[model samples]
Target: MTATVPTSALNLVGKVFKPSELRFPAMPPLGLYIHLPWCVRKCPYCDFNSHLAPDSPLREVGTASVIPLKDARNPRDEAPLTHALPVDLQRRYLDALIADLDQQLPKVWGRKLHSVFIGGGTPSLFEPALIDELLGAVRARLGMPMSGEITMEANPGTFELARFEGYRQAGVSRLSIGVQSFSDSHLASLGRVHGGEQARAAVAAAVQLFDEVNLDLMYGLPGQGVEDALADVNMALGLGTTHLSLYQLTMEPNTLFAAHPPELPDDEVLSDIEDAVHARVAQAGFERYEVSAFCKPGHRCQHNLNYWGFGDYLGIGAGAHAKISYPNRIERETRHRNPQAYMDEMLAQARPAEVRSLTVQELPFEFMLNALRLIDGVPDAYFVERCGRPLSDLQGALKAALDKGLLDPKPGVLKATPLGLRFLNDLQSLFL
Candidate 1:
C-alpha cells in the first residue's frame, strides 16, 4: 500500500538527521527482479498490472504453427483466449528490458547479484528461446554468481514439457508455478484459465524439470470450507513441491470483485481454514518462515529473503520497483506503470516515474516493516547496518513493545512475540 505524508511529519520529536549523517557498515546483498506484464486474459479478481494481449495467431503448446482453437478443443467451451505472442513483440520487449537494466547498471556497478526473479502475469507465455535470450543478456551485463538462483513464474495454461526443459537448459534453477487451487469449481470462480487437470500436469512437469519448485495456493474462496482448503494444500504437497505460498483471497479496491464482492467464507471459517492449513503443512515438515510462505528445510526463497531482510534489489520492466541503498542514504525507484510507456521511456533514456529518499524518521518504521515479517525476525545488527541507525534509536519503541508483550526480550536479536505476530500491524505501528 502507498501512503502520502507531508514532509513536515518527518520532523519527529523535533530532531532531524541529514542524509550525510547516515552511513552503512557495508552494502547489503543485491537481487534482480524482471516483470512481464501480459496474460492471455485478465481475471476478474486480479489487481496486478496485467493486460490481455492484442489479437494475434493462436497456437497450442508444442506446435510450431498456428492452429484454430476449435481444431484441438471446442472453441466455445474455452474462455476467449489471445493468440501466442508475436515473436517480434517478444523480442522488442526483451530488448526494452535489457535497455532498462543497462540504465540501472551504474546504480549497482560493483555488486554481484545473489538471486534473480522473473515474475509476472504468466511469464510462461514467452517461448523458451526468448527466455534464453533474456537471461543471456542479463548475464552479459551483470555478474551473477554461479550459484545464484534464477526463478521464473509459470502458469499451468502455458506449461509444456519441451518448453520447461528448454528453460532448465537456459540456466533457470527454480520454478514457481501459480497453481492457485486444485479444485475446478474454485478455479472457475477465481477466473483461472486452466482447470485442475492442467494444474496437476504442470506440477508434475515442474518437479521433473526443476530441482526447486514453489506452488502458489489460495484459501477463503467463495463457498470454500476448511476441508476444501486443506484438500488443496494436501494435493500440492503430494506433487513434491519444496515451497508453498498460501494466500487468502482478497478483494483489493478498484478490482471487479471489490466492486461486486463474492460471497466468501466468513471469519470463523477462514480462521479454521488457516489453522488447518498451517497444521497440515507443519505435519508435512514445512516451516512457516513468513506469514504466507512455507518451505521445507533449505528451500526458502532467496529473492524474497533479500526483500524481507531489507537488502537492496534492482527491479526492471514495466511497473517494477527497486530499493537501492547508498553509503549516505536509501532511495526507492519505480518505473512507468504502462508497458508501452515504460518501453518508450527506456528507448528515450528518461528518468523513472518516481524516486524518493527515505527520511530518518521513516527509516525505523520502514526497516521494521520488512524485518518483523519474518517469523524469527532479524538480528539486531541488521537494523543498525541497513537503516544506519544505532540500536539506541529503537530503544524507546523496543522497551514499549517488550513491555506490551509484542516483542521478545532476547538481547542480540529483534523478534516479534506470538502476540506480536498475531497483531503485526499494531506492533509495527509502535516504530512510527
Candidate 2:
C-alpha cells in the first residue's frame, strides 16, 4: 500500500509545478475494462486470475465439495469442460458488477470513454442475456459517447451463431475468440476445451455475424514445429478474421507449466518459427502493428490501442487493475482477486481498494513499457504530453540508445530500431 504524494506543493493544475514534482498534463483518452473472473477450467500455462466455475465438479473434503487446484491429475489431460454458470449465479454476479461500477464512477466522473472491453476468465460462458443486461446497465449509469467500438473476449468452445447475434444486438461491435491453435493435438496440449474443427466453425460463424473479429493463436508449443505454427496462422487468415494475436507460449511464474516444466522449443527453433510466421502474415496483408498483434488496415482494436498508447482506463471487477489520472497525479487500482469475496465486498457497499499515485521517479520506465512496444513507436511530442516531461530530461539515455543503434535516429519519432524490436527487453530496460 504505497501512499499518494501530496498535491498541495503543486499549484499549477495543468503543468509541472517543479522539477521534482509530477505534472498535471491534459487528460488522455479513457477506456473501460470489465473483468468476469470465471472460466470453464484453468489451463496449465495460463497465469491469469481465473478460477473454476461453481457448477464445475469438485473434490469432496469432509462432506464439502471444493474447487481446489490439488486434484493432482495431469493438466494436459483435463476432463472435458462444462461452459455454463447457472442462470441464478449469473444474476448474482451481474448485481455485483453494477455495484462495483457505481462506486468507481466518481473517480472518472464525466469522462467520455474512447472504448470498452469485456475480458474474462470466460465471458461467453454466461448466457447472452446476461451480457446484454451488463452492457445495458453500464450505459444506464454513465454518459458514454455513442462510439462504435465495444469489444468482448469469447471462448470458441461456447460459440453459437444465435449467441453471437445476441451479442451484436447487445452492442458488442468486436469479438476476440480464444482459439489457441487449430490442431486437435495442439489444442489438447494447451488444455483447450474447443477442438480444431470447432475453432474453425466458430470463427467462420462469428465473421458472418460481426464485421470485425479477432483470433488468438499461440506458437512455440511443447513439440510444435515451424510448419505447425504456419498451419495455424494460415487457417486463421483463411477464416476471414480481421485481426490475429500470435503469442509465443512462455511458462510464466506460478503457472502449472512453470512447476511441471514442459519441453518447450529451444531458442533457435523458436526464432525460425517466429520469422516464418511473421513473414507469412505480412505477405497476407496483415500489418504487425504491435509486438504480438496483427491486423488489416482500419481494423485496429481501439480498446487495446488505448492501453499501448499509455492512455487512461477504468477497470472494474474481480482481480481487475486500472490506471487513472487526476489534476496532479496518476493512480493505480486493483480489486479483490477471489470472485466470491469480490462480490461479497462490493454488494455490501464496501470501498473497493486504495491506490498509490505513481511517483515522478517511476514515470519514465512506466511510460516506456507500453509505448516502446509499438512497431512505429510513439512520437517525441507524445512523451511530453502524456508523460509530462520534456525530451531534454532523457538526453543521456536517448543518446546511449542511439549510439547503440537500439533506437531510430529519425527526428520527431522515438521508435525502436529493427534490432531494438528484436531485443525489446534490453531496449526498454535502458529507460529503467
Best by lDDT: 1
lDDT of 2 by residue, 340-362 (tens): 89989999998766677887767
Q: Compose the digit string of candidate 1's lDDT tens values, residues 1-432.
A: 112222322222224445446756667778899999888756666788876665423322232122222332213454433235666777888988988999898898888888899998778878789899899989998866434799999988776688889889988999999888998778767767677887899899999889899999999998899999999999999999999999999988767777777788999999999999999999999998888899999898988988998888999888999999998889999998798898889888888899999888888888899888899888777766677666667879999999999999997677899899999999999999
**Can you tell me which runs of candidate 2 are displaced by over 4 Å?**
1-17, 57-83, 144-147
TM-score of each: 0.90, 0.89
TM-score, model 1 to reference? 0.90
Candidate 1 ranges with C-alpha deviation above 4 Å: 1-20, 56-82
True lDDT of residue 108, candidate 1: 86
* Cα error, candidate 2, residue 173 (Å): 0.7
